[model samples]
Every structure is written in structure tokens, then in C-alpha cells.
Target: MREFLQRTLVWLIVILFIGLAFWAFSGPIEGLIAAGVALLAWLGFHLYHIALLLRWLEQPTAERVPDGFGAWHTVFMTLYRTMRSQMQSKRKLTNVLERFINAGEAMPDGVVVLDENDRIEWINPMAMEHLNLDRKHDVGNQILNLIRQPSFHAYMKNASFSQPLVLQLTQPRELVISVQLVPFDSTRKLLLSRDITSLERVQTVHRDFVANVSHELRTPLTVVGGFLETLSDMEEVDQATLSHFLPMMMEQSRRMQSLVEDLLTLSRLENSPKAVMAEKVNMQDMLDTLMVEAEGLSQGRHHVRLEKGCNQWLWGSAQELHSAFGNLVSNAVRYTPEGGDIVLSWKAEGERLCFSVKDSGIGIPREHIPRLTERFYRVDRGRSRGNGGTGLGLAIVKHVVARHNARLDIRSEPDKGSTFSVIFQRERSAEPEAQPENQA
Candidate 1:
């Protein structure tokens, strides 16, 4: 409005000046003619500016706004300011959206976005992996169609978001996922998925451990209770009967005691902080003691020999190493057949010091090797029990090895032999003359 008024005012001034000048030299009719000519020229000037405005409007950028004379100058400047402000606001919004997408991609858990009609809108990389979805092809498709699990379909249909659903997916990999749906904006929903396979495995192990413990205790308890009941019911126990049952009861009682002790040792190793490596263990003396224990356990059934390749001492808890090594030797002694060769060695290979037990025993199958360190796991349950094993030796050995920063390697072939080795890093072993600083 202001520009229009300004132009009108200028036009009137031009007409008046031209009219008066012509009137002074000529007549009123000639003055009227001059005013009309001035009006035409003024219109032409306005038309030129109008054309420039139209050309600039096609692109309508701040940088391309045309400069104008008189009122059009104000019009062009206003357009420039407005256009620049809008561009800045748009750039900020774009940055914010980019940051949001980047955060979604970086998240560890899977995130899937659904539209009002339950169509796939956006999904993070983790979501793509968890759902086995191709982002290019899966986007804009119905989420239910892609995930056709009946439970998941029912979960979506029910719209109950209070509890998460546990889904076992077999595509891409066998995965146990805990999924939850969250509603937002009165129309859209967020589907969140978390991998819980490890958690499920732990729970299963816990249940199995409880059952095994109960079963182990029940057998001994039943034996001891039955013998006691029989002795109590007798009026006068004969000498032959007493002799027959007493030793058997004592053996079962000892077995139970051993099991309890092993359980305590394993629990301590697992719960305690890393073992103190301050004590310097004499490897030669330790191996000799293990030789004596192996002979005592074998009772001339197997030939046990010690091989000391290096007399280097180790920097670790002597008691823990003794227990770990003793378990290995005892296992070898018990498993080997009569006259079988059982070798216990403290040797160096490359940059490591290894204490290994090799035996000519009925070796374990390949399938059982991976789970040998699991508590109470056995290749043959009856044979292991007959040999008086608590089934916690390897588990204890594993914990001890981990505490000492060592690795346990097991190699075996059926009917050939088996070797169990605990390999320690070079830093753990030192010569007699140069021992490491005590790090208690």
C-alpha cells in the first residue's frame, strides 16, 4: 500500500510540473497534452520495473532479488530478508533430522518405526539385522507381512504393550529376542528388540545345575540311609554283616565330603578376586609332589612319570596352581588303563610355559571336548562316578587358569590318548636367579 501511494504521489508531481511548464509557454490545451505525455512516460517507467520484478520472481532467491528505484527498493529488500530467514530455518531442521537418524543407527538395540497403518516407515541397522529385513525392499511394506510369526502377529493385533514378548527367531541366525511395542502420537508405534540368547542359556544352565546337585546328593543319601535303617532294625548285628556294610557306608560318606569340598573350592575360585601372584612356586618341587600323588592315586595300576623340561618357577598362588595341577594328574591316573603311560611335564614352548598331563586312556570324543570345562559335565556318567570324580575338576582348572591369565588346551582322540595342558604366558615364568617383583 505504501509503495503504491509513493508511486502515485510521484506521478502526480510529474504531471503537475509538466502541465504548468507547458501552460506558461503555450495554452491550456497544450498543457493537457504535455500532462498526458508525462503520464504515458511514467507508466512506461512503472512497466519496466514490473517486468524486472516478474523475472526475479521466477527464481525468488535472496541473492537474485533485483535492485529497484523508488518504492520497489523496499519491496526487493523485504523479499531478500524473508527468503534468507526461511533458508536458515530449513537448514537447522535438516541438521536436527540428520542427528536423529545418526543416533538411531548408533543404538545397540533394534528400533523399528511403524506408521498409523502399521506400515514399515524407518528401521535402524540393528533392527534390520534382528528382523532380517532389507531396508530398500522392506520399507513401505506391511510390518506384519514381513514378520509372519503367529505370536508376533497376535502381539500386534492385541495391542497389549505392558509386557515384552519373547520370540525365538531362526532366520539369519538362531536368536532369542525380547520384543516390546510402544505407542506414540496416538497413531504410530515403536518396536524395540533386544537379544536375550545368552541370558536364556544362563537360565538353562542354572536349572540344570540345580537338578544335577539334587541328583548327586540323592544317591549317597539313599545309600547311607538304607544301611543305617537295616542296622537299626536288626536285634544284634553279626560281624560279617557289619564288615560288609560299614566300609561301603564310609566310602559313600567320603564321596559326599569330596564333592562338598570341590564345590567350595570352585565357588571360591569364581567369587574371589584374581589370585595374588606374589608367591613364587617351585615348579620342580610341585611336579615331584604331583608325581607322588599320582602314584598314590594309581596304586601301581598305571606307570606315572614326571618330565621337567625347564626348572623355571612360576609367579602365582602356589596353593591354586597345586590344586589345579593335582586335579589334572589325578584325572590322568584314574582314567589310564593298567600299565598305561601317564606323563606329567613342565615344559616351555615358544614364549609360554606349559604344565601338561598326557595319558593313554579311553579318550574323550570330539563333541564332548568343548563342554568339558562345564561343571558336572562328563563323557560317561557311570564310568566317571565309578572312578570317584565329583565332575568339578575341569571347572576348577578353568577358573584357576583364567585367574592366572593362562589358557587350557585339551587334545584327545578316542582309543589313542588325551592331553590336558595349562599354558602360561612368559611373564608368569622366571628363572631361579631372576624372579619377578612380587605383585600381591
Candidate 2:
């Protein structure tokens, strides 16, 4: 309002000056004629300035503001400054928006922005993968139409986002995705999704492990309790009956002891951050001791042979390797029949050195081969228990091999035979160092 008044005052002063100059120059008639001419000239000048202002307004970005005299000059400068300030602010906002988008793209979890109608406005790459969505083509499409899971549709309609929904997809692989929606602004929604399949598997394994441990312990405890009750109840039992019962009790006690020891070994292997012992282990000597132990376990049932094909000794914890190799030999003796052949071979295949136990035992089915290393996972539970197997031998072997950067391979066919091989990398194999007699 002040600017308007100032402009009005300036125009009035110009008119008054023209009147006074005409009055001072000539008489009333001449003065009036001159005044009319002067007013026309002023009108033409103002008209030209109006045309420039109109052109500037039409293309403010293309044309610069017109330089004007007096109040017109002030008006042009004010509009120009305001427009420039607004442009600068808009540029800053655009830069900030671009940075926000980049950060969202880099996130591990999926992020999706939706409008009031649940139409996908924008989605990151992770969302594209999780939902199998094509951002380029599927944008502006309703999320419900694409991800047509019944649970997700129901959840969307309910508009309750306090909890997340887990969606299981079975197309490419068995994937578990956790999804949640957050309402922001007035009608905008933000959808978040994360792959939680690994977490879910771990939880399942933990539950199964606890249940298996309980089941294993319960059987032994029940047997021990029943026998103790029987012995206490029968005060005058015969010597032969007592001797049979005592051996049975001792066998169950030994089984329990073995189970407990294996569980402890597993616990220690998991808890230890790194291998504790680093020494040159003589593979030939290790196999020699293992053969002796295997023979005792076999009780002249299976023909055991040791074929040392490689002189490359192992460099690692001797105790861990022994426990691993010993388990393989023992398992072979336990599983192989009376006349079956068990061949323990240590040889170099290419750059990898392998210690394998091949047995002509009751072979495993194809379906059960993948889970052989799992704790307490047996192909035949009754047969394993009858053979005095604690079900944790292969699980221990797996951990030991992993610690030494080795791989365990199992090849088997039902009714044929099975071969279990532990392949160690060449870097892990070392030449046996010479002993110095002076120290002795």
C-alpha cells in the first residue's frame, strides 16, 4: 500500500511540474495546447513501459526485468528480487529431495511410497525384488492388485498397521518377508519390507534342537529309572537276572555319557572364536592310531584298511582333527556289517588333500543325505540307537572341518555303500618338520 501511494505521489508531482512549466512559458491558450502535447508524450512513454512489463510477465525466465524510471524502476527491482529468491529456494528443495531419494535407494530393506488410494507412487529396488515388481511399468498400479496374497489383501483393507505381516512366497525359492505399513502426512502411506527367511530358519532349528535334546534324554532317564525301580522292588532276585540287568544299566549309562560328551564338544566348538591349537599333525601317524581304534570298535566284524596316498601332513589343532577323523572311522565300523570293507584313504586330489572313510555299509537314501550332518538327524533312529550311536558324530565332524577350512562330501545310495570325504585346502597341508636331536 505504501509503494502504491508513493507511486501515485510521484506521478502527481510529474503532472504538476508540466503544468507549472507550461504556465511559466506562455499564456492560457498556448499553455493548454502545450499541456495536451506533454500529456500525450507522457502517455506514450508509460505505454512503452507497460508493453515491456507484459513481455517480462509472459516469459519471466527468458526476459530480464525492464529498467524503469522513478516508481516503475522500483516496481521492476522488487518483482525481480522476489522471483530470484523463490527460484533459489526451489533449487535447494529439489537438491534435498534428490538426496533423500538416493538414501532410500541404498537401504537394505524395501521402501514403498503410496498415495491415498494405495497406488504405488515410488518404490526402491529392494521393494522391486521382494515383491517382484517392475517400478517402471507397475507405478500408478494399486499394490493389492500386484501382491495378491489373501493375508496382505485383508491386512490392507483392515488398515491396521500396529503389527507386521509375514508373507511366504514359493515361486523362486521359499522366502519369508516381513511387511508393515506406516501412515504419514494426511493420506500418504509408507510400506516397508524385509527378508526374514534366515531368521525364521534359525528360530525353527533352535526349537527343533531343544525338542530333540529333551526327547533323547527322556528315553535314557526312563530306562534308568525303570531299572532302578525294578532292582529296589525285587529284593531276592537271582544272580543271573541281576547280572543281565546290571550290564543293561551300564550300557544305558554309557550311552548317556556319550551323548553328554558330544553335546559338550559341540558347545565348546561353537563358543570358541578360533582354533586354539596350531601344530604340524602327522597324517600317517593319525591314521595309524585311528586304524587301531577302528579295529577295536569293529571287533573283527569289518575289514579295515588304511591307504595313505599323500605325505602332506595337516597344520591345525591335532585334537580337533583326531576327533573328526576318529568319528568317521568309528561310524564306519558301527554301520558296516560283519564282512563289510571299510577303507580309510588320505590322498591329494589336485590341490586339495582329503581324508575319506569309504564303507560298504547300509547306504543312505538320497533325501536324507543333505541332512546327515545335522545334529541328532539319523536315517534310521532305531538302528542308530541299537548300534550305540549318539547321533552327534557327523555334526561334530562338520564343525571341525569348518574350523580348518575344509569341506565334507557324502555320496551314498540305499543298499549299496557310502563314502564320506573331508577335503582340506592345499594351504592347510604342511610338510612334517625334522626333529632336532640336540634338544632331546
Q: What would the TM-scores of all predictions be?
A: 0.89, 0.91
Clashes of 2: 0
Task: Give one digit per residue, the lDDT tens place, for model 1 in 9-69.
Answer: 9778979999989988998899989999998888887888899989988888879988877
lDDT of each: 0.91, 0.88
Off by over 4 Å in 1: 1-50, 238-240, 433-440
RMSD of each: 3.9, 2.8
Return model 1's CA RMSD, one decimal: 3.9
What's the residue-level lDDT of 146 in candidate 2? 92
Q: After superposing candidate 2, which stretches have Cα over 4 Å from the reference?
A: 1-8, 62-72, 435-440
